[model samples]
Target chain A: MSADLLIELIGVGKSFPKVSRASDRLRALTSLLLGRSPGRVSNVLEGIDLTIHRGQSVGLIGENGAGKSTLLKVITGVYSASTGSVRRLGTIAPLLELGAGFHPEQSGRENLRTNALLLGMSPAELAASEADIIAFADIGDYIDEPVKHYSSGMVVRLGFAVIAALKPDLLITDEVLAVGDESFQKKCVRWMERYLADGGTLVLVSHSMYHIQKLCQHAIWLDRGRIRKQGDVFDVTQDYLAWHEKKSADTGIEHRLTANGEYAVLRFALNGDTGTLPIELPLGEDLLVDVELRGRDDRAPVFGIGFKRVDGTAVYGTGSEFERQPAKRLAHGHFAWRLRFPKPSLLPGTYVITAHALDPEGVRLFDDLPRTVIVRGRTPELGLVRLAHVWEDPT
Target chain B: MNLLISLLAHFVQREIRERFLGTVSGGAWLLIGPLLTLAAYLFVFAEVMKVRLHADAGDSFVVFLALGLWPWFAFSESILRGTTAIRQNAALIGKIALDRQLLVQAAVLSAFLIHGLGFVLVLIVLKLSGYALNLAGLPWVLLGLAGLALTAYGLALALAAAAVFLRDIESVLAQVLMLGMLLTPIFFPPSQIPARFAWFVSFNPLAVWIGCIRGGLLERGLPDASGLVLAGGVAIAALLIGRFVFRRAAPHFEDYL
Candidate 1:
C-alpha cells in the first residue's frame, strides 16, 4: 500500500460456474443450498499478483476466453475476487463496457449531468466543464436528443468525451479505441498520450499488438486464466506469439505411417537432430533439411521441403523438381535426400518445416512430416521478413 | 449526507423531467395521473354511492377524497417504482459504481413530491368551499406526508432488494398494492368499519397518516398526537429494517444482474 503504487493485487483469483446444461445449473443451485461448491467450477483468473504504479501504462493481451475482461472487471470493483485480496488507491474510471452508465431516456446533454455527478463531479464543477465536454463530443444538435435515438458511434463519442474530460487518477478501459472512426481513434490515442504525460495511470486491454507496443510501457500476457509472462510489451508479446505458434502447429497434428505401404518417411531431421522437431535457427542462417525414406522400389523418388509460418501462412515451398534434383538412391528400397541452404534469407518468426516424399513425377504426394522451428532474431521490426537496407542522407 | 442529498436531488429532477419528455405541457403532465384517478373515484363514491367524509364536510367529498387519496397514491406509486429502480438503472449500476440505494430513494421522493402538488390543489378547493381550513396545521400535514414518504421509502428499499433476487416480487407487489388500495380508508372513513376490524385501521400506518392529513387540513386541527407517534414509530422501524436488508443484499446485486 505504498503511496507510489496505485493498484495492487495479491493472489487474486476468480471462478465462474460452468453450467451449460439445465441439470448442471440445477445441481449448482442445490449444491449452494447444501453448503457445498457446485459442479465444474472453472477459473478465469488465479494466483494473480500484479502491482501498478502512478504514471505507468500497462497492456493486457490475450486470446479470447483468456480472462482479460474478467480481470479488468475484478480490478474495477465490478466483480469481487473469489480468493485473495486487491487494494486499489485513488479514484478509478472504468470504461469496461462503454455507455453502460448513460440513461437512455435522458437527452445526451442531460445524461452528461447525471453521469458526471455519478463520477463525483459537483454541479458547479460540471457546469464549468460542460462546454468542454460538449465540444469534445462534437455532436451538435443530437445533444438535445434522447440517448436511445443515438447511433452506436455517436454513443461512443459521448462516452469517450465524458471519460476524457474527467481524467480520473486511474483509467481502466477495454477496447475503447477499437470503436469509432480512424480520426476518432487517433484523437483518443493522442488524448491518452497526453493523459499519460500528465501522470495518470492506465490499464488498457486490446488485441492489436501495434497499439500495445506503441502505448504500453509494461505488459502482461494472460493465457488460460493466469499470467504466462509479464514484462516489456515487445518481449512478452514475442514469447506469447511463439507459444501460440507452437501450440497451433501441434494441435490435432498426428504422425502416421502408411499401413502396409511401400514408401514411408523413416526419419526427418532439422539441423542434425531427429528426436525433437524444433531446432532454433537464427534469422538468415542456414537451415538443413535431412530426410531418410524407405521405398519398396527405388526409381529415384521425389523429395520436397517447404517452410510455412506457424499459423499456416505459406512462406516458401519447393521440391526436387524446383531444385532440379531427384532423390539419390543409396541402397535397395532406401534413399536419402539432403537439402542445404548456405544462407537462407527467410523471415524471423515461428516457421513449420515439412519434408515430403513424392513419386518421381512429383504430381501426387506420398508421405510428409511437419516440424515446428523458431527463427529467432533481435530487431524492433514488424512483419514476416527483415530486409537489409541503407538510409540515404538528404543534403 | 449533503452529497447524497445533492445527488438524490439531481436524480429526482432527471426522473421527473424524463418521465414527461416531448410533451407540450411539460411538467403539468405529472399531475394528470393522480387527478384523473381522484375525479373518477369522487364520481363513483360521492355522486353515485352518496358517501361523505365524516358526515360533516357537507358535499366537499372531492377535497376529503383528494386528501385521503393523493398521499396514498404517492406512497403506492413511490413504493412500486422504487421496487424496480435498481433493475431499471442497470446500465448506470453496471458501469459506474455508486451508492445504489440512492436510486430507490430518488424514485420514491420524486413521486411523493410531484403527487403532493395535486393534494395541495385539493386543499385549496376545500378552503374555497367554506370548509374550516386551519393554516397553522400546514407543518403538521407536511410532517404527516413526510412520515408516509419515509414509510414508503423504507418499504421500497426492502422491495427493491427482494425484487432483484426474485422478480416475482414485482407482480406480487402490484397485486398487494391493489389490495392495499381497497383496504385503506380512502373512499370511506375508519368509523364505518365494524369494531372487530378497528385494529385494521388503527394498525395501518397509511390509515393514520391519512387521518392526520384530513384532520389537520379538513376537520380536526393538529391531528391526533397518538396517530402521529404511531406514524413516526412505523417510519423509524421500517427504515431500520429496510437499511438492514438493503445493505445485506447490495453486494449480490451484480450476481443476479
Candidate 2:
C-alpha cells in the first residue's frame, strides 16, 4: 500500500454468523469449545476489489440494505475481512455513525479531546487545534455542559466540528453531512469542497444523489453485497435511481394483478405506445395514459390518474370521480380508460404515472397500474411542476 | 510502546476528570469519597465486630484493617469499573481505531490511582502517630501496589471482554465481587479463617499482596520471599492471559454491538 494509492481492497469478503435464536448462539459457542465450525453464515460483503487514490472522491450509491456500510467499515479497518487483503495508507478520519465516539456524560470539550486523541492526535496537537474545533462547533455554553443535555443538532455540530478541524488525508464518512439544519449542512459541503481542493481523498455514502453527483467524481453502485456498477457519478447514480423507479412500479403492478377482483386492469401504457416503459417526452408536451380493464358485468366505473416524483413525492393527482365523470363500457365486460394532459409542464425528473379503476363513487379502488415516465426540459428554475407565467416590470 | 503508554495515560487523565465533572467539588470528591468509606468501615469492622488479626503487629484494629484493606479496595474498584469499561464506551470502540486494551487499562489504573492516593495519606498519618515506621518497607509498599494494579488490569481485560459478549457478566461480576470481599481479609483478619481453609487466604492474590505490605509496614522488613514471588507471578500471568483473551475478543466486539 503506497502513500499515493491511499486504499486498496483486493477481493475482500466478510461474513457474519446468522444467530437468531438463543439455542443457535449456544450451539455456536459449543462448536468453538469443541474446535469445530459454527453453523449457518451470511456474507455481508463479497469479492470487492477497489482501489482509491489520493485526491479522488468516490461515492457509494445504492438502495437501503445494499451493504454500503459494511464496505466502508472494511476500508476503515474497523472490521477485518474474512478473505483477501486490505491495505490502507495515509491518515483516516471516519465520520461514521453520528456522534459515535461522543460520551454523553462528558462535555463537548472533553469528548473532543478523547475523540481527537483516539484519532491519533497528540495532546499538543489537540490543544493547538482545539480553538478551531470550538469555533466551528459554535455550541457556546453547551460545549461545557454534559453532552446528554445537548439537542440532536448540537451533537451533530460537535461531531462535524472534530472531523472538519482534522482535515485528514483520507476522510471516510457515511452520511455525516445529512444531519443538522440545512444551512449547517451547506456549510459542511463548502468545508468539504475546500478539503477536497487541498488534495484530500473521500469515500462518501449518502442517499442523496444531488450531493453524490456534486461532490464525487466516481461512484460505485452496490447491490446485494456486490458491486452492481462502477463508473462516473452521473451514470451510476442515474442508473441506481432508475432501478429504484422500476422496482417500485413493478411492485405496484404486482399488487394490482394479485388482487384479481371482478374488475381487473389488463394493460397500462403511456404516450399511446409501448416502445419503452418510461416513454421519454419533452417538457410542455402532451402525456397520454391508456388503461384497459375487464369488469364482471357492464357497469360504469370511475377512472383516476395521478403523477408523482420517482421518490414517491406527490406532484399532481386527479380522478374522474372528483369531476363526476363515470367511465362508459365500450364493449362487454371490457372498458377503455384514457386520461390526457395536453401540456404536462412538469420539471425535468423521473416520475410515476398511476392509473386506477374504482367504483362509480371512487371510494373503493378495485385495480391499479403504475408506469414510470421521464420528463426532459432545459429550465434552470427548480420544483416539481412548472407553471406558465409572464414577467412584468414596474416602472 | 512509548506511544501506547502516553495514550493510555491520556485516557487515564480523562477518566479521572470525567468521573466527577458535574459535582461542585469536582475532582476533590475523589479523595473525599474514599476517605468517607474508610471512616465508615473502620467504625463498623473495628468497633462493632471486634476482630483482630496479629497482636504483635499493632494496637489499633482500624490501623491494621486500613493498612490491609486499602490495596484490596483498589483491586475491587478497578475490576468493577473495568468490567464494563468497553460496554460503556461502545461509541468509542466502533468509531475509533484504538487499542481496545488501552481503554480497559486506563479505567482500571485510574481507579487504582485514586484509591492509592487515599492509602498514601493513611500511611503518612500512621507514621506520624509513631507506628514503627521504616523506609525499608517502602519498597514492599510499592511492590504491593504494582501487584494489585497488574492483577486488576488482567481481570478487567477478561471481564470487560466477556461483558461485551455476554451482558449478564456485568451483573454476575458485581455480585461475585461483593462476595469476594469476604474471601479476602478486608473486614476481618486472616487468622479468623479455620486451619483447613487458611490455605485459601494464603493463595488468594489480594490477601497475599496485603500480607506483603503488612510485612513491610509493621514488621521487621519485606514479605515472605515465597509469598512475594507467588503474588508477582500471578499478577504477571494474569496480565499475559488477559492480553490474549482481550486480543481474541476485540475483533468481534463491533459485531456484538
Candidate 3:
C-alpha cells in the first residue's frame, strides 16, 4: 500500500482442478454435486508475498510445474487469488498470453482496433495510433489480410508491436519472448533494455538464466507453488542452481554393500592424483573421483561417474564400461573406488559429479555420492563443453 | 443516464462489427430465414389449403401477418441470442474489465437492428401493394425502440446471469421463446381470442407491444393509449428484475468462468 510500490502481493495462492482427457463433462458435474474434492487436482501457487516498486525489474525462475505461469496470472489479475490480496497502484498489462485476444477471421488492421480497445484504448485513440502500430509490426501488405492467413510469427510480431507501443505502467511478460526466431528474440531483448532505461517496471518469467542475469536486479525462485528463495538475482540464482544440481545427482543413483539395504555413503571427494582440489586443476591435471561405500552385500560392485551442465545437459558420461574396468570383487566390508580423468575438459558455469554403484552386470546396487562441482571458465566464448583440437597450416 | 447511453452505443457498434464482418449486403441476409418461413406458410394456407378463416373480420391477411410477425421475431431472437452471449465470449469475461452485461446488451441490440430493417422492408412492400402509413404513426417507432431497449436490457441480464451457473438454462430459454411466440398475438389481434383466453393475451406483455405497432401502422393511429402504458410498465418491470439478478450474480462470474 506504500506509494513507492507499484505492485504488492500478500499471501496470495491459487489452485486449479486437474482435468484429464478421460474425464468427461458429466463426471465433472457429478463430482461437483457430490461436494467431494477431486483426488487428482493440486494447488498451483501458495503463500506468495512480494512487492515491486517503480522502475524495478524482477525475474521468476522455477522447474517445470513450479507455478511460474500461475504467479504471473495472479499478478496481472487474470486469476483472482483464492486467499489474500494483490494490490496495484497503476494500470497493468499482462502480455501473459500473447495474441490471446486475436480473432482469426478479422484482418490484422481490424484486429488492431479490437486489441487496442481491450487494452483500454478508445476507438479514436486506436485510429490515431494505427499507423505507428503497422509500421512497428513491419508486415506491409499483410496488415490488410485476414489474420487466419497469417503465419504464427506474423501474429506475434503485430501483437508485441501494439503492446509495446502502449508503454503500460507495469508490464507482465510470461515466456512471450520464447516465440519467433532468434533475431526477433534479440530485438525483444533490446526493446526491454530500452524500456528499463526509460524507468518502466517489468516482471519477467523465463527459463533462460543468461537473460535473467543480464536483465534482473532481483529474482524469486519458486518450487512446488511457494517461494523457495528470493533476493539479489545472482545470489539466489546461484543457490538455486546449486540445489538443482545436487537434486539431479541424487535421484535413481546406485550404491553398494551391507547386510541390510542401509549402506551410508561417506567421504565423497573429487581431486587430482596429488590430492589437489578440483578448482586447482592445471591444464592436463589428473582428475580423481573418490567415494566410500558400505552396505549388506559386497561381493560384486560397480561404480560409474557422470558429468552434466547446469541446465541438465549432459556433456559427457563414463562408467566401468567405457573405462574397461571390471567389478571390484570384495567381502562384506567398507570399500573405496577411485575414478580418474586424464584431463578435466569442462569449460564453464556449473557442473555436477554423480557416483553410482551397481552389480557386476549393471543392476543398481546403492547410491554413493551425488555432489556438484563447478568448473572454472578459462575465457568467455569457450562454451560449456571443451574438446581438444589440433590446429595445423598446410605447408 | 449518459453513461448508460454511451455503454449502449459502445456495445451496438461492437455487435455490428462482429456480426457482419464481411461484405455488407445492408444486413438483408438476416431476414432470409424469416422470409423463407413466411413464404412457406403462405404457400400452405393460401395455395394448398385455400383456407380463409375470419379474413373479413380484419384487414388484408398479409398486413395482419406483418404486424404480428416482425415484432415477435425481435423478442424471440433477443432472448435466444442473449442467453448464450456471455458464454460465447468467455475470454472477454475472464480477461477484460468491460461490463459483463454489455455482452447481453450487444446481442439484443444487434437482433433489434436486424428486425427494424426487416420491418422497414415489409412496410415498403405494404405501401406498394395499396396499404398506407399513417402520417401520425412516427411516434410509435420511437416508442417501440424505447420499449425494446428496456425489455431487451431485462432479458439480457436475466438470461446471462442464469446461464453462468446453470449451463442448460440457455437451451431452456430458447425453447421457452418458441412457446412464447405462439402465446403472443403476433398473427392475429387479441380481440379474436375467446374471453377466457383474453387474460393470456393481455397479460402476455409482448401481445400489447406488438398490438400497438400493428395498430399504429395498420390501424393508422395509436392503439389504446392505456395499452402502451401497460407495455411500458411490463418492460420497466423486466428491466428492474434483470438488473437485480445481474448484480447479484456478478461476483460469481469469475469463479465459474
Candidate 4:
C-alpha cells in the first residue's frame, strides 16, 4: 500500500457459521470452541485486497447478499476480519448503521453528548460543535425531547448533521441516504461531494448505479463475498449489471419449473450455416437459434421460437400450430430445436431469441431458454430495433 | 489524574440525573426507600421480635439502622449497576472510540455519587433526631465512601467483563446483594452476632465497609483501626482485579456485542 493510501485491506476475510434452527445455541458454543474456518462457514468477505488513496471516493456495488455492507463495516473497524490485516492511516467515521449509538429514552441534547462522545469527540469538542450540530439537525424545541419521539427522518438528519460537522479524515457510508426525503438526500450527496473535494477519503456502499457513476472514480463489484471485478466506476458497474442480468434471466426460467417440470430449455445459442457464431449479420443473411432441451418423458412436444428486438418489439415468432404444420414427437432424449430468421432486420445492439416447447393441447411442456442474442450494428445505428425506412421528399 | 477526575465528575452528574429522571418524583422520593426500610426494621425487631441491644445508643433504633442502611444501599446499588455497566451499553462500548475502561469506571462513580448524597442526607437526619455528630470520626465516614467506591469499581469491571460472555451474572449478582445485606452488619451491628459467625462478617467486604460506617456514625467515633485497614485492602484488591478483567475483555467486546 502506498503511504498516501488512507485505507488498506490485505487478504481480509470474514466468515459466520450457519446456525441451524434446532441447534442455534449449541452451534454458537460449538463454533466458538471449533474456531474460525474458511470453508466451514459462510464467507461474508474473502481475499478482499484494496488500497484507497487519500481524497479518493470509492463506490462499492454488488448484488444483494454480496457482502457490500460487511466490507464497509470491516473497513471502518465496526467488524474485524477473521483473517488478514487492515491498516488505516487516518481516523474513520463509520456512517454504517447510523443512529446506532443513540439512546431512546435520552433527550436529543443528551443523546448528542453520548453520541459525540461515542464517536470519539471530546467534551470540549462536543460543546464547541453543539451549535453547528443543533443547527444542522434543525429540530428546534424538540432537541430537548427524548430521541425516541423523533421520526426516522429526524434521527437521520441529526446523525448526518453531527458527522458532517466533525469532518473526519475518512468517511464510510452505507446505503442510509435512502432513508431521508429527496431534498435531504440531495443535501447528503452535496455534502459528500464537498467532503471529497476537500481531500477527504470516502468508501461508499450503495445499490444505485447512477450514484456510483456520478460520484466515484473507482468501484469494486463483489459477488459471493469476493471481488468479482474492480476498476473504473463505469466498467465495473456495466460488467456487474450484465452478470446480474444473466443471473436474473436464469432464475426467470427456473421459476417456471412448476409447469415445465424437469423438461426445460438448458441453453440457447445462435450460429450461421457454417456453424460460425456471428454477432451481427448482413441484412439478407440467415440467423439460426440452437436450443437444447432435456426431457424425461416423451411428451411429443412442439417447439416455439421468437426473435424479439431489444425494446420488446417482436420481429417474428412461430409454433407448429402457427405454421399450419403437424406437431413432431420429442423422444425421451436430448434434442436441439433450431429456428432460422431470414433477412432479420434487427437494427443494432442486442436482440433476444427465446425457445420453448408445448404439447399438442397448447400446454407448455418445456420452459424458455435463458440467453439473449446480440445483433451487432453493420452500420452506424439509428435505433436498437431497425425498421427499414424509405424517404421520399418532394420540393 | 485530571482525565480520571473529569471523567468521574461527568459520570457522577449523569448518574444523578438518570436516577432522578427515572423516578416519578426524582430526588424527593429517594428518601422513601430508606424511611420505609427503617420502619420495617423497627417493626420487626422492636415490636414483633422484642429484641433489644445493651447500648441505649440513640433516641430511635430506626435512626441507627437508617444511617447504616442508606450507605449500604449505595454500595449494593453501585455493585449491581457496575455489573451491567459495560454490557448494557454494548453499543457504546463496541462502537464508541473512547477508553473502554473508563466506561466501566463511570458506572461505578455514578453509583458512588448517588449513595454519597444519600449518605449525607441520612447523617443530617441523624443529627436532627438528636444523635450527636462526633467531628473526630469524620475521617472514617469518608473512608467508608472510599471503601465502597473501590469495591464497586472492581466489581464493575469484573462484572462488565463477565456479563459479556455470561448473561446470567446480572441476576446472580442481584441475588448475591440480597443475601449479602442479611449477612452483613446492615440492619444490626456485628457485635450482636455469635462468635463463630463473626468471622463471616469480617470476611465479607461489604460487611467491613458497612460496619465501619455503622461504628463511626452510630457507635461513637472512628472504626477499629485494623477493620478499616482490612476494608481498604480488600477494596484495593477488587480495583486491581477488576481493572485486569476489563482490559482483557476489551478487544473481544466488538465481536460479542
Q: Can you give the lDDT of residue B33 in candidate 4?
A: 58
Error of 3 at A118 (Å): 0.4
Q: How many backbone clashes does every candidate have?
A: 0, 0, 12, 1
Candidate 4's C-alpha runs over 4 A off are A1-3, A15-43, A254-395, B1-12, B22-24, B31-40, B55-63, B90-103, B215-233, B247-257
**Per-residue lDDT of model 3, residues A82-132, tens digit only:** 668999787677776666767687789877766666666656666788898
- For model 1, residues A103-149, the per-residue Cα lDDT tens digits are 88789999887877777777787888999999988889999999999
Highest lDDT scorer: 1
I-RMSD for candidate 4:
4.5
* Reference-based lDDT, each prediction: 0.79, 0.78, 0.70, 0.70
Q: Write the per-residue lDDT of candidate 1 for residues B1-257, one digit (tens) a residue.
A: 76677799999998888667778877666556566787799789988997755645453667667778888888999999999998998767666767889999999988898788777766666677777677786776887798899999999998887776566788889889988987878888776777898888777888878877877776463346686688789999999878877876665466555
- The residue pairs found clashing in candidate 1 are none
TM-score of every candidate relative to the true structure: 0.85, 0.78, 0.74, 0.74
Q: List model 4 lDDT by residue over A336-364, tens digit each.
A: 56566676776534455667766545575
What is the fnat of model 1 with respect to the true interface contacts? 0.36
Report how far residue B23 has shifted in candidate 2, in Å: 3.2
C-alpha RMSD of candidate 2:
6.9
